[model samples]
Target chain A: MKIGMMSFAHMHAYSYADSLMKLGNIELVGVFDDDLERGKKVAEKYLTKHFSDQENFLRTEMDAVIICSENTRHKEMVLNAAEAKKHILCEKPIATTIEDAEEMIEACKVNGVILQIAFPVRFSSPIAQLKNLIDNGELGDIVAFRTTNRGQNPGGWFIDKNLSGGGAVLDHTVHMVDIMRWYLGKEITHVDAMVASYFHDIDIDDAGILTLEFENGVIATHDASWSRFAEYPTWGDVTIEVIGTKQTIKVDAYKEHIRMFTSGAKSLSNVFYGNDMDFGLIQDFVECVQKGKEPSITGFDGLKALEVALAAYESSEKNKSINL
Target chain B: MRKIVYKKLEKIDFATTTAKVTIVKSADQLTEGIETFLVDEVNFDSVINDTDKVYIPSTLLNVVNENLYVYYELEQYPFFKKIKEVIVNPKGVLRFRRTGIITENQRLIASDLVVFSAILGEPLTIQVKRTTPAVTPYHTIVTVNFGNGTMAHLEYTFSNDDEKIELEWSGIKQIIEFNSAEMNPFSLKNYTSLPLAYSVDSILATARKADQNVLNRLEEFTSLLSGGVTK
Candidate 1:
């Protein structure tokens, strides 16, 4: 199968290339970047043919396209890709706005092409296990959950409101929302949020907290921020604690249960962690394409996550809970 | 071909923050005894530019350490300043990554800390490698002393074509201790202490959440394992 890349500006664009390369069956036709220099640089690094113009890249005889552009540009790119009848692998936080996300979803549907969001976390072995546990009724019903995905502050176009839409809240919160929907097997009915700019002085919020109530009455709280430093042992983690009617499951990923702290300072001189989910997710995406099945993380899934993020932001702005 | 790998490293613990970079290039591209500061002074550009190449300027870098001040002649010009000489200990390069107060304020970015690995060259394929459990053979575990205490460490064997590989985690220890006088147990050879801190222990919380999420998803895998695709 031939696959083309739409943009390389997004952080995951390189990863998408890496994924496509590892899958083997997919031939990378070419890639385009908004800036020719950056595009060429990325194409060189990934060793793929690159097109300087978007039109030229889209016109390639490719079976699919992966839209790994900025949040705001996703809609137009998706629409353009759909017009070309290319199945899509758009990155998460699919669009900065709900309208754009809806438009992209509709466009993909109308084109009769699969539109998958790049929510690779769902494909992780552990996360897949979590889904199984829920489906098997091991946890019974989720009572309350708290999720977080913090990291060091990021710069570039991500800090610009016009380019990235919102800051940490928009970029980070969407993942939690997506995972929540994935686990709850229900929609997020309402949200109460508190957004802040306590970290670095940027145009957008560097931190945010959201309270979510699922349609099934299960509640959850999420914290998304750029909180890591150069001195901390670990960069970030995503954890969930669900108090279901049956059991309480907690995954302690960073507990170097068997680690050595250097000196009197425990600056995580050495950490024992693994990042195996990436391979599994890529394998699943490739299989989905080969089998003509929808990707594990679909465009509809991407829209649902964005909807929660947008609702949280609107809720934070109004100082009230948003009803979804 | 040039490659980079993280080894037994040491770092400093601060009520504030800092980053210590140790770059050893196979190519003689690096100037010997050069102290480059990658400060995440998030808003440094909007603030001030050092006239002398004394300190490098970056908008995304922060200056969290205050103890050791390395001086260099700033290559001052109309537009930007370049580093002429960086006066570091030559022992290791130090720069601030973040602070406690700064870390406390940034609890909103807890969703994007995922580690997704993929191949760099031809044929175009991607896969999500498990980032936990230190799977043996491919990932090895060793002991590292960060000065006053013990650290359980895991290092992965390098694949032939890994362009960029990173270790990610949630930093949530109450009081971190890294500065040791005698041997300086910190890993001076590598970039240490990539703090992933968040408000109210967001890191561990998120990990637990991810665990549960994964546990729930495992049912599907279990079904596939059981030769049953139908729900």
Candidate 2:
């Protein structure tokens, strides 16, 4: 499949771009970035042409486009991509607001193109196996979920609440929320959260703990934050503990690593030897486009996850549970 | 360390995850040679051969469903007890979060509120959320906000033995994690609370049928269940 990448704003764009090169069947058609310099440099590094204009970029011969724009700019890019009759693989927190998310989904549907949201956690092998177990009733009736996706603050436009929608809570909560929804096949009924800018001297929130209820009557909690320091062994962690009628299972997605001690700077670190979840995600997207099948993770899935995350902010500010 | 003295008594029975320790009441309990025990608890004494093991009352063990050493028995639990060895001063805590999946017989929420109240002042507001499976409440989450902008959240669920737990304290610059999976632990330090378990009359009376903390939480859960004003 020929895939063009829109906007290299998100850091994940680099990883996805690398995955694009790794897949033998994929052709990295071109890259379009509003920032001409960064776009040209990325295009040159990947040995592809750089499109300076969105019109010309969309006009390129590409089956799909991966929208890795800023969180606030996702809707505009998705609408443009859909108008151009190109399938889209959009970065998460599909849009900043529910209206934007709904509009994005509607446009893609009207255009009759696949709109897949990027949720790489679902691609982790252990997570996949856990899903299988749940589906097979190996764990019995699903009861509760305890998850965490805490990472170090990725400084930049992320600190700007307008650009990133919010902060750690918005940035981190969507992934696990997507996974939970997929596992239970239910919608979040209510959201209550405690959010604050506790770590860094920033205006946006840096820490948040969310308590959520699902349509299936399962209660869950997620601790999403930019609370890790520089000395932390790895960038962050994505861990989940699922409780069921018969058993409970805990998983640390990034736990398969070797703890290394070096002599010089950056002394202690964990060298991960686990699956590249991004590659798995892109591979799945590529398969969907090649097979002309519906996206495994639809835009509505993205919308539902975003709704919970947005409600979390409202829940914290209002100090009450926000019902969907 | 005060020497723990005990009288020969009926029976002392307790256990960890692996082995079960039973001290039979009579002098004939031990027929073999001197058996040494790395003692941490006491209930009664025995005329068993050698070791100078002190008598500990049964009140010491944090029992759940007749199986001890499951939940946050901070006094002897290696991991949580680490909190005493580490953080000598409990100040400037930004937030606190604790999550546990355990078995509970009562609709009590945050049974261990004393841990939070000890550090962060009295909770300004306690918010309770419970999950009812059929009739019995299977889950409860209590979120407490202190007047000083400090917030603590505790989640508890019933019929789950996944007791590997952790207590977290978010300080200004660092996060303190006191979890069940503690690494190379040091000797437990002396806590200020006198051991009520070792008291003479502790065994005679109903040994902590329910502490004040658990009772208060029970009241809160009760009120919440009845649609009380939730803040």
| Candidate 1 chain A lDDT trough over 10 residues, lowest sum | A250-259
Candidate 1 lDDT over B158-212, as tens digits, reads 2222111122222222212221121223455233332221111111112221133
In Å, residue A283's CA in model 1 sits off its true spot by 2.3
- As a whole number from 0 to 100, the lDDT of residue A46 in candidate 1 is 72
Span of ten consecutive residues with least summed lDDT in model 1 chain B = B111-120
> Which docking band does candidate 1 fall into?
incorrect
Q: Give the Å error, residue B202, model 2.
A: 16
| Least well predicted 10-residue stretch by lDDT in candidate 2 chain B | B189-198
Runs of candidate 1 exceeding 4 Å displacement: A252-266, A269-273, B1-231
Candidate 1 lDDT score relative to the true structure: 0.53
Please name the candidate that would achieve the greatest TM-score relative to the true structure: 2
Among the numbered candidates, top DockQ falls to 2
- Note the DockQ of each predicted structure: 0.01, 0.20
TM-score of chain B of 1: 0.17
